[model samples]
Target: MARAPVRSSQAKVVSNILEKHGYQLGQYLGKGAYAIVWEAYFKKWRTNVAVKVLMKDKAEAEFLSKFLPREIQVWKGLKHPNLINFYQSIETTNRVYIMLELAPGGEVMDKIRMKGACDERTAGKWFEQLCQGMAYIHSKGVVHRDLKLENLLLDQHDNIKISDFGFCKFAATDVKNLKQVQLSETYCGSYAYVPPEVLQGIPYNPFLSDVWSMGVILFTLRTGKLPFDDSNLRRLLKQMIKGPIFTQKHASISLECKDLVRGTLASDVHRYSLHTIFDHPWMLPLVRERPPYLRDMDALYLRPHLRRSTQRLMTIRHTDGGTRSTANLVSSTRLVHPEALRSPSPPPSPPAHRPPLHARPPLQRSWGGREEGGRAESERERERGRGLAKDGRRRE
Candidate 1:
């Protein structure tokens, strides 16, 4: 059976529910199998926030029982610059609402899709941030099993914000030494990002798998393509076992960059640890320039659709004798964040070198009238004609 599209009626109902809690739902952001995300204005925060809503009835029992709880547990405690900020979570009788920091810059994948692959410097800058975020996550004994380009988002400043904790797990630790307890047996996450150990159905280190996923992301960012083709699952597993084959397609990437990729995607025994990746020669230079910010050139890769939405949000309403801009409305309501008003593209400047008002020609109306000085000129002409007629009459 075909699934129905998100109904406007349903959205209206949800919007009302959110309003009761001091939130006003804006446009639809995105959705997954179990949840829908919306851009919303939170009154208390006086900021625009992302709200993830999961319907209890629609979601799977397994998610409700296991993954959802784990995600919330992991997300609530995390505090890092690169990680998305978790505001709060609310549970009602039939739904669960999770509020999060909205990254205005949108997804990293959006940039790649809009423009081709990122240049080496740009890619390296983001990759370094990703590593830092992962390092922090691992330190907390959490593993992000679903790492991918799509999950990495950018904020207004264009710094990476790691998001989506649905598949995350707290790594089991031994009590005596407080070291890792055992390998994760669950084969979960996107097939394209999963490593060979995960594909072989063997117990695998979740942290290492995440690193492998990061490697895949880096490769795609540099080459504009996934390292391995996954059309044939059987062949893909074999190909992964054989290791990623570097080709002429990858010739543009530096030797050091290739070395990092090779290290991360290596066999389970030889896979590069997150610590090792941080210390690698390729990543060393990028480390100094930590917490990378977006450059003017990088702005070209930003999602156009998001830019349009931002412009729409800040649009001014013009009416006769009354002008009410969205910015004013936001201020009055104390709803939208100031960031929402910022457009990626600057407003067009007025044309340079305007003629002096007296020197400028009067605008002529198409229906045989002057827009400005033409009326005065016409009146003078009429008076002159009448005087000429009077003179003729006198002479007669």
Candidate 2:
């Protein structure tokens, strides 16, 4: 059955609230069963933010009464650089609005779809950030319960941001006098990422289940495929219960990487803790080179611009004229924001007439070939071009 739409009056009320708060709604970011996300400009702050609008009616009263409050409680207290930043929330007679830090770089799943498989170094960097973010949240007694690729977003700088707190729960509120570790019987998260125990309808440690999801992520990163992919739910569950994830012999990944994947995918009793995963030989190099966390000011300014650029690019790609001349448009955008090159499109082959946006100068290490400076240069050039071409009419 088709879901009911928010009443026109309710939507108008939401628009009024946004405008009253100095936010101008821009483009649709995405939608789910209960909420819709839009890119909006916060005029007062001179920043771009994502507004998640959730409709509240009799049908969704239970969700509004339970999950929404829990989500707000967890999001309001989170301050990690690798987790999505929640600015504030507003409530109305018929709806709720959540203002959030937008990650314009899109989901890790999109990147996987574009590049087939990620190089080990790139995957390691992302994995390290995921571990740090997960560790921070777990320390606060919250278990994410969902840790799939779609829930993992990337910022303009390629940093990971863990999102979607709808299924998040506190394992223990008071750690001082904890008598026993908390366990949850809730069956949540995506089917492919769900741990075997959760599928068996048994009480399980949420933290351990999260670790299993991470293991699935690592496997997908290396192979561009799920470890237990199947259309049949029963067959998939059986595969999850079976030991070992098969890796391609020809794939370029270290044995230590495979070992970590295997260990994280193990049953709850043998699953590695987040700390142990961080200390693993495969993750140690990234740990040693970890950058300082983003300050509040840095995030406040950078996030908006990135989101705006992403919206512009997406809008352009969808136009008929833009579709035909996508190469030039893509190159032009890349000239200004090299990170745009990594957007969900397949890795482009360099045109014979011109150098590709991703072409990099020789570097000291094979794995260090993807240059940050190159991306910065492209972005600068693209901005200049935009200024010069402002008078040109856009193709409809």
Candidate 3:
């Protein structure tokens, strides 16, 4: 695909601006549809950073004008160990530069591709991190419209960092107002990972869609394959809408893990909420084992003037009567503590009186399970009954 050209003048302008701000742009990292990432050295902080440069042209100016700023604003408010850190954004006449943390361990998808599949323990650890990250973002009233293996990067310690906010949007900031906020109907996301509601062209809750995508990721991690896969797009969509994601009988995975997947991939009524997923039998151990909040003291100790100056530049361009901007938008750049980015209290512990895993009733089943055969027969009978009723009505 042809990318927008970064002219020599624009390049020099960006370079001078970075130099003025005590940053040295280094080697090229990667490129996407609208941006190019480069390794950069921040002389002031004495740390390596990833700089994402987005070129602007007349053709895409309007779209970039709205999207780029929203992305910057979203990143500025988010600070979590499992999320990619955003430093600042620099905008010029023809380009926008985003400073971010560099994840040298590369993408999770690459690792999965190399190993085919991961053990349940490893998958559980990664899934915990993914959930924590998602929880943080959702708490901030943002929904990552796209959550897949490819967008998950790893740090040196093998910790997951959720990246790529191009498709993210603010859903709701106030808990009480959640139902009143307009639901998103935009059809966007990777086809293989998209939820049934989205594919059916219904206005869907973005958070639920994100949860579905996470379920897809979990399934991929366990089996190294998509839960719903087919060459024909229509066939794949049909399978997704028809219900049930059949796991291979030979795949060695526990029922608890399968239950989590089924719960997440279930219809809206039966789907597990993000908070509920955290307390699930398969997730409780990993959640309790989460590492302590690793604080970057330097960020908290940033010079007051420097912080104020950055905040002044973080302008949120508003179009339409307060309808376009995210709710609870941080107008003033307050000193964000690591603790402030997360919930003030710890996550709730699982109930002490809960039954052991083996004793509990089977959770919702997607495909092959103890009751799979019975469920299949039941579904067939229901379908036949519906067909006969339709035939009689037509005859009448």
Best lDDT among the predictions, by candidate number: 1
Model 3 C-alpha lDDT per residue in residues 175-219, reported as the tens digit of each score? 333332336766666556777656555556777778888998898
Task: Rank by TM-score, highest first.
Answer: 1, 2, 3
lDDT of 1 at 312: 35
Report the Cα lDDT for residue 64, model 2.
77
**Model 2 lDDT per residue over 1-396, tens place:** 121244467455666789898887776666554566777888888888888888676325556777789989988899988999999999888778999998888878667755566889888888888988877776666788777777788899999999878778787535443223466766655556767666555556777778888998888787666676322334444466564455455257888998999889875655677756776888887784433332211111112222332333334322321111111111111111222223333322333342322342321111101112443345344335433222111110
Clashes of each: 0, 6, 0
Q: List TM-scores for all candidates, in order.
A: 0.70, 0.69, 0.68
Which candidate has the highest TM-score of all?
1
User: How much is the lDDT of residue 25 in candidate 1?
Assistant: 84
RMSD of 3: 19.6
**Global lDDT of each model?**
0.64, 0.62, 0.61
* Candidates 1 and 3, the one with greater lDDT: 1
lDDT of 3 at 218: 93
